[model samples]
Target: MVVASRMLFRFSIVWFVAVVSCFSQDSSQTYEVYVSKNLIGTLIEAKIISKDVNSSKKILYHAFKEIERIDSLLAWQIPTSEISKINSYAGKSPVKISYETYSILERSLTYSESSNGIFDVTIGPLTQLWGFNGDEEPTTVPDKKAIDSCLKLVGYKDLILNSNDTSAFLRRAGMSIDLGGIGKGYAIDRASDVLKRNGLTSFLFNAGGDVLVSGYKAEDQNWTVGIKDPRKEDKLLGSVELTDKSIATSGDYERYFEVDGKRYHHIIDPFTGYPASNSVSVSVIAESAERADALATTVFITQGITGWQGTSDEEFLIVTNDLKNIFSPGFKKKYHFKSIK
Candidate 1:
């Protein structure tokens, strides 16, 4: 169920200080340990505050280990990954997979169906067609005819899940699923579990921009995240305080190219086979990073704030194309948003 409300409020924004700066100041009782590495195509960073530095490093080691395991299992570009294997066996037979991969795929399909296929996992063909799936930047826009053909192979319904045997299959020969939209969030959740299991209560695990935080930054200060202005580089719209929750943001500025004065972004509309144009950016705060990540993409494609149906726990913030800020009712109530002018 959608956990946040659909009601939204707009305001002329103002900015505040970046909250992350305070984390660097040393605390007298606890040692703050920070670690970062390149993983899952982006930087994964973590901050652990503990009484012992050795224990903090140990906890981070286990956390990173869990994340690396998830990347190996879900990364589509890795030939040995279960996702790649599923794509390889498309239209032929079901490939048995790990419970973790199967469960994540099942959850991904749920978002796809709930979002009316606007957040499809079977968007691999379209991603590759626009050259957004690879290392090199796309220099030109793809042909409309080519896009139309690729769209035929892009449908979440075509991804068949056999829960009984823990296997998955793509019904069409060319249909493939890319977990890129949701995998990192799932990984962060897994890593968070590792931290908790190690008896670490205060830590923040961030995979790229998807963040899951628990406990407080200091004694009572909640961890704060800056919301980036989608149109302005190096400028933040505001900051929001969070604890024991996850937040993810999706934006056209993340990956895009301009051609003939038109900007083509990575977030594609499955129905139209082009960049979704409803909103410039969408940020979702949910109980799990997985849900926040998928909902961010779903809401971005489904007309931004207007497309969102709220649940008690999930809240969202959207920046319209005109650069106006829209906040979910729960978001406004739950988080103290310090906006920048």
Candidate 2:
């Protein structure tokens, strides 16, 4: 009777431990990472859902590290970054780079081609001249001679890429490339890849206003993303829902300064050497954050109402400076915009 009672006590303890483990597995985990301070620079926060506690932590940790790595590698401010090296060698010889950097640069060149230079990567000189690149601030608008000189260096065609993704070269000196418009989205996409490889079943990765959601938040519910009003800094224009997709928003309100009552934001028109004026804000949704990010910037610069009508592959919402919204067809079909007004 004593032996049988002892066996029953051990069995109850085992069952209790199993129950506690199950409860822990069903819970959620969250992490926050701060990388920089621009509208392009942002703090990232993510919520990961998984059953394995060890794997969840590992995935989240690695994802944040991946973003930091990308930031350092792509930042033009960092003198030792691969991009900085490339810019340093402009008008000279080809600068060899890692396959990762080569891949992104190659993709950027393609976008620069397709967008007809609206999304030129070689606009760094223009950005710097306007005091928008890195941490520089100018008290007034740049001179016409300076703007014209930078425009000479702002052509995407000047950036030459190699076939093997090993190296790239700039056609002339004084030309530089800026990846701030697309780097955040590329980093977010890579972070998502890390999470998937670590076996996360569900997640929401947000870097400031740029966000990517994987799987459902609940059994059947989607993730809700808030859209800020273009005119009002503290108000929300509406909200959109997403699942297994990414959304990237670029707005004039996110970064800029007023010069004699005229606002100058970061999204510069390569042709005019000035901040784009057609769209006050542009939010894009696509299968990947990289695409969404690139399109969001491209649309703002392109200044078209339909937003690249050649491609129905993604959805977009472009808000003009007057607060008028022009949405892509997919938005009307797939989303129900909730107005906060």
lDDT (Cα atoms) of all candidates against the true structure:
0.88, 0.82
Please list the residue runs of candidate 1 whose C-alpha ends up more than 4 Å from where it truly belongs after superposition.
1-28
Per-structure clash totals for the candidates? 13, 0
| Model 2 TM-score, all chains together | 0.87
The residue pairs in collision within model 2 are none
Question: How would you encode candidate 1's per-residue C-alpha lDDT over 187-302 as one tens digit per residue?
Answer: 99999999998899888988989999998889989999888899888899888999999999999997899988888999989999999998899999999999999999989988
RMSD of each: 14.0, 4.3
lDDT of 1 at 28: 61
Candidate 2 per-residue lDDT over residues 278-335, each given as its tens digit:
8899888888888888888989877655346335657888898788888888775675
lDDT of 2 at 300: 86
Candidate of highest TM-score: 1
Using all chains and alpha carbons, the TM-scores for the candidates as numbered come to: 0.90, 0.87
Q: Residue 304 CA error for candidate 2 (Å)?
A: 3.2
Question: Pairing residues by index, what is the TM-score of model 1?
Answer: 0.90
